[model samples]
Target chain A: MTTKDIGPKNPVEQGVTQVVDFVDERSGVKNSGRWLMFRNIPAGTSWFQTLGFTAMALFGMQAITGIILAMYYKPDPNTAFGSIAHITNEVTWGWMVRGMHKWGASVMIVIVFLHMGRVFIWGAYKYPRELTWVTGAMLLLMTMFMGLTGYLLVWDQKAYWATVVAVNIFASAPILGPYIGDILRAGPEFGPDTLSRFYSIHMLLIPGGIATFIGLHLYFIIRLGISEPPWAKRALRVQRDEEDARRKAARNREAGLKGSVSFPPAWVDDEQEVKR
Target chain B: MKKADKVAYDKDYAAAKKDGKPFFPYAIYKDTIIAGLAILVVIVLAITVRVEMGEPVNPASTDFLPRPDWYFYFAFELLKIFANQNALTPVIMATFMVPNILIILLVIWPFIDRGPERRIWKRPFAMGTAVLVISGLCYLTFLGASTPEGIAKGETLPLTGLDAAASAGEAVYLANGCSSCHMIKGVGAPGPGPELTNEGAKGWDNAKMVQWMKVPVAPMPSFASLPPEDLENLSTFLNGLGTKYK
Candidate 1:
């Protein structure tokens, strides 16, 4: 199993190594990979961390399928529903793509919330990880909005009325209620123009918002690394502090400066032995 | 870490990594394989199942109920709770306020639970909050799924201040079902009584208001059972509302 004990290193392997060295020497990507993979994460952190990465992978699945769906999805209310029908029945492999995107949205939300639960329970969002938590919250909001906006793009009865109920909810706000409603519906009532507006928001704005927040959230997670669960039998921090203090006190006494301070003469040049 | 613990940790680490390989090939290979497997799952599903569609939207027909997606069914139940009540805004409470409150709680959770303790039992407050929030949502969602969807009507409660006194009065007002008769800031059902939103602007001080409550105008029942202190606090709240709105 030892690599050095293997028969001769193949020329292909040599060439790959040469290429890797060239790229890594300039970009230091090898170091970044090393840092990511070898970082000292707390033990027993396996399952919950998987949820975050799984959500991301699911997001990737959604993006790909959504792009495919959009290629044939017309925004015109007259043809929008027809377009969806055509995609499922006529377009090759279209139904699968659309179905995955639909289920992916629901599953992504579920997994993200589950990941958040783990984070919250472990007290991993404290102090230094506040930004990560905030950004994650933003991501959650944007993802839900994406689901809401995208649901309306189907232009079917269920999607239309569901959207109507949703817009009405926003419109019921005490102040600026009607304005928000108009923004959501694109008019007083759902119409042809409303479909296009929601299409753009669902396909572009909300996904962009999710990506932006997720990007920021992941950046912080990588920087901070994974957090430890407190249930682990960790050593006492106070004990370490006490030991450090004791070491400092012993060093001060050995240097002949224990409790003797008068400006500078008592501590000046004891190591170098310079004359005062 | 004390020196002894540090030495122990180093020994453990060495023993653990004795046969370990660099992450470049080992971990990366595992991650790539997992990613590939995930894609395969998606591919398999895509080949078999299809996205479903319903009839095109027609505003002319009012037969089909426009229900939300499954994720929003809990909200659907919420909308149904205040259905046509005209006295409360279920949408704001169920969809807007509740969700925002949960989000805010999460954003500020780190600050509130600043202790280093992460064990579920050790941090009861954090654990309790998470359990309550998650369970509440799941319950609401379950109810929403079982119920039919309806229009989301809204009610307006314009009680602004969060002071203990003001909030207590607000609670008293609601708990007493004063909203059933007298409206506040366009909230509650329309009643024969005058709007109490601007009660303070009428030049009636706290004493006058309290006395008036004891011996009242026609159609305005006297809340004689109200304690003296609650009367004063309610007066302050009413008076404060007038000034703030103005």
Candidate 2:
């Protein structure tokens, strides 16, 4: 509201602001920027709700390290194991990147499972959040598969046999057993093709699926605001939300426009001010 | 917020202000610290430990055992237990039935437990089942980790003759390194390939032995690269272990 709030004249701050403003302009964050950064959570929201965000952060870590690992890895029987050795011993910081990737995966799984536990315990998946739960389940499957496929990329003796056992497990799917095994192993038994197949899936297909599901999951979370903590007065929260929706519909009707999409608090307030 | 929604949220917001902190520096600040700590942990591990990569793949020799990464020990142990129970027990049950069923249960769990309560005691059935599953997995995984691999064990066929391989077959047999796994009696390290001590006794003539060499079962690195002459000599050497089945 005043020049003083804009900021003091400092070149460094100005440069940073310029870059940020450029990005914000391109991103169209404008009003929604506030929605993302400072949206109203239930007064009862706590650190417990941040588990999902933490899982996402860990996933980003996995993706970064995974991409780097893919660079020097050769998905062939002859060199796959050896290349990993080279990365560990020969490439500088490669071991750290790899170890982080390995540990990150285990940690990511732990965090994701914990996030699910939090969601379940909170009963946050009830009522309107069913699709959020479904998308999350899909994400969970993709994450586990990513872990499985990534295991095969190491090409060591253990990697080979473990994958063989996993492929056999796929073969146990009644009628689809042999066919699934063929697809996974790329043949009747493990060979060169199996490594490449697992590599592509680990690096691309599964990550793609995960990314898509994450988008849907977050979209649902934002559209239907994060569920209130179960300990919060559920009836009161629901009643308030329904009443808000009813009033919003009435205002929309007065403006001769049907209700389109639900608006968060700011836009709703703006509409109300216009109505007044 | 519409008038009613704004009133409700504002009331909560003002009440929350008494104790609640802004999410930005508070939530993201906590996230940054944790993320940095996590990265530090990863870096420490990366620097301190090197993942053990075992010897080159020797499909023919069963000397090297294959195990999975630690996370899969539950499934690995399940298979091991099943195999111990009945060698006839299909691996599929452990591989598909157990894990997939657990996953399906996880996916559908929310729908099944749609109730108004969130207290742990109120959800006794769900909480008990979860604890049981987690404890079982931990126990099984520990067992799996400690267990060894030998379910599909193989034995190397012993043979003899330090200097010669059934006449002129010596060079070809050693050239392709067939002797490493298929040894003359008391000649090489113990291996997992079938004992050729008296492979000739199995009754396949020279031709049959060579044909079999082209493609072998899994975990046996294929010998598809052996030259034709090499194949013939190895076959000769294998067959000439020279003993009667009786």
Candidate 3:
């Protein structure tokens, strides 16, 4: 509600307003929240535009599930496998949590790709939103690294060897390869330290980077405002009207000085235009 | 975009926003619905397709297939295309060049295509690139997924013409789990490694094969720790694949 409604309210509403006002005076958080929530967005913002938010929701899901898994997971080599087994077979609702985490990784990947595809196809990355695309690209790469590092956390035979080959591929890069490999493995070879290292990188480092980039990405999106669909009727009409006006101006110039070279008036009122 | 185009875009966006609805209910409803549906899909998948526990890791064992998750399948498949370590299709293309090029391209795409026209049909180059890249990735991922895992334990290579040394080499291959990567007469996994059914066609000596085994390319672990005699025998067996052992 607007500030004018503050004068008339029930006891509960009055108490809530008092608390909100207290915080608002100190931090101006209430005003900022209102600004964020009540901002005007293009009416043509389509369903496809929602993919980014969906991808973010999945990331939140992953974070919650990952926390639960971390509670029971032991990152040490000797105990890692056993801990996974215990989580899957013994802990209450642990299997469900682990399943959600695993499946969530895959689902997140799908959503992220779809989001990128939507952005690409719509050309939403153009103009003032270039940095938004850059931040989004960072998030995509981080999501992929999240998958790579998280794969090995299971400590299964498949994950272990896949990671070995992956690191080897990194190490195979010219000049910088070997160093990257060593850092990833925490030594020259996979050992006790490798598992914990991956666990830390997966849970801490990449997630932190992703969160930071997400912040930047959201800032850009809000600042730039939502991109309008190119095929929207209003956009097409605008293009047509501009073209017509340009052509008319050229004709009037060709006809020689006709008074002040007049142009058509602005768009009609919303109701009248809709009635047509 | 040009300076004029940028100015026009800002003006148009401002006008659009002025005539638009508030973010509180209009856009939020769509975002919530789609995101909620996505979470529901994840939950349903987790419930129906329960995750299975694979065999525990054993560092000493080379019998395992080093398969990545499905999303990385395209990259894994790329390794196979350039697995030969030859001049034409160097392994570096897969391991270093292509992936890095792709990432760089991805990050800087906005700069690459700065045109103000957002209509899909108007941008042939961008549309073509999108189709090519997306389809290429999908095809590679499909290939990676369809490729079989290494032959099951106790399954032997379907080959002929084994001499005593070659037989000894086959024994070495079977014992060391080379089948996990390579196929001989269509008996092993199709990828992450090249097929070795006609490996002898290369016409290398036993010595060259032995050397390669010790210092192989990335993604292929070294076999230097194997005994000298075993390496020699394996090299002899491999060097005569299509010519002698086929």
Candidate 4:
């Protein structure tokens, strides 16, 4: 039962036992892992160590910095500019935090785009992963909207007129464009109310949407695992041989490569590699 | 089918075991704590922030100087320039038609350049077009911003006997709705009325002034209600007002 005694044991077997125990304790199908529902799959693959993790890290940064910004930000036009100036000049480390948040917004956009691009290039969106790609696209659109709304909260002359032109562009979108534009503005004009509405959406509603999507996205990602690149077909064969050599080398290094495993045990190791 | 089913079933069993426990040691506790702290911070900050409102807007003031927002100043200036009449000029080319064409070009750009490559270097044509259009807009906007407000060049009107004429003409200006059409020293009703300051100094003769006043043309409204004497006096007042410019 001691930790050292269990060291290097079948982690996969241990993990499966633990999941079964948890399911027994919880007594609900809802809490059960999909593996229980479907059964019979290989496990213990480090699938999360990829572009998805990078995107998650970026999202974590955005959440932290966005909170810091919401502390001092005022959505009203008159004081918004002054409040931003004060944040830059007066507040401790406010400039750095704001700069990170501003740049982080742009970085998040770029990172999500790259993440999506990688998925596309790998053809991960081709089959069962189509929903994952769709969710990701929704996240991208939401992030852009978050950026746009956040920009308007600054409420300077530049922000004001840029939004004016942007709203006019929206108004150009056939019949519903004008209606959508009006609803977005929250009235006939871009005034304090528009800023308030945008601030609320930026801070609350859009983040709520993104949070839901992220949950679903993470579920799909974990369920599907990372898609192997096209070269993986050829690499898989080479990788098994490499794993055998690595395992043999590891065993030898442990007992000074002069030591040798029986042929049957070596065969089992070879079979396990190919199974993966 | 049986072999595939067995493989899938085994895979699922292994997956279930792997996913059974929480991914991290303190998953529920840590996640809830973090979510609570974040929500608390947002609420506290939202409540504490003070937003101040500015003064109310008034649309009817002349002293305020109605200029379009900076982005549209270039267009505003363009409109003013094109409103002018001159030889060797195509006003519509600069004003309506060219801008309309550029907008059309922009609207159809995605279709025209549908190459899958998204890199800036690879998409030289798209990037170049963007740069050219933006630069041209910036240049026009700059020119628009720089144009000063005032009367046009090479325009003048004659004023005869204006010392007595101005006092009589001032009265006529008020009575005959002259102020409705024109701005005198920046205070008057908004209308197509010409600015009367140094008006007579702009090379326009008394007869032309009378004719123009009797029957307004194009942008100017007619003053057919005014008698000949009132017209003369009103013209005299206008002619006298801009003597300093002359």
Better of 3 and 4 by lDDT: 3
lDDT of 3: 0.87
Model 1's CAPRI class?
Answer: incorrect
- Kindly list the per-residue Cα lDDT of model 1 for residues B1-246, writing each as its tens digit: 235433433443333343344444444454455545656666665556656778788754433345668777666655545332334543346546765676687677666766434457667777777788788789978875554232123433666654777766666666544554456676753332346777666777788878876665322334656778877877766666666543
lDDT of 3 by residue, A78-148 (tens): 98999999999999989889999999999999999999998999889998899999999999999999999
Q: Is candidate 3 or candidate 4 better by DockQ?
A: 3
DockQ of each: 0.19, 0.18, 0.63, 0.04
TM-score of each: 0.64, 0.67, 0.90, 0.44
- Evaluate all candidate structures by whole-model CA lDDT and list the values in order: 0.66, 0.67, 0.87, 0.55
True contacts kept of 4: 0.01
User: How far does residue A106 in candidate 2 sit from its true spot (Å)?
Assistant: 1.8
Clash pairs detected, candidate 1: B89-B154, B89-B155
Ranking by DockQ: 3, 1, 2, 4
- Total backbone collisions, model 2: 15
A134: Cα error in model 4, Å? 0.4
Residue B103, model 2, lDDT: 87
Superior candidate under TM-score, 3 versus 4: 3
Per-residue lDDT tens digits of candidate 1, residues A1-276?
655654337999888888998999999999987777775544434444566667677788888888999899999978888998998898887777787787778777887788788788777786457789888877877878888888888887767766765776677666787798788778866666888999899888888888887889889977765555555444223333344466667878888999563344322222232111
Q: Please report, as a residue range, the 10-residue window in candidate 1 chain B with the lowest summed lDDT.
A: B147-156
The most accurate candidate by lDDT is 3
Candidate of highest DockQ: 3
Poorest 10 consecutive residues by lDDT, candidate 3 chain A: A266-275
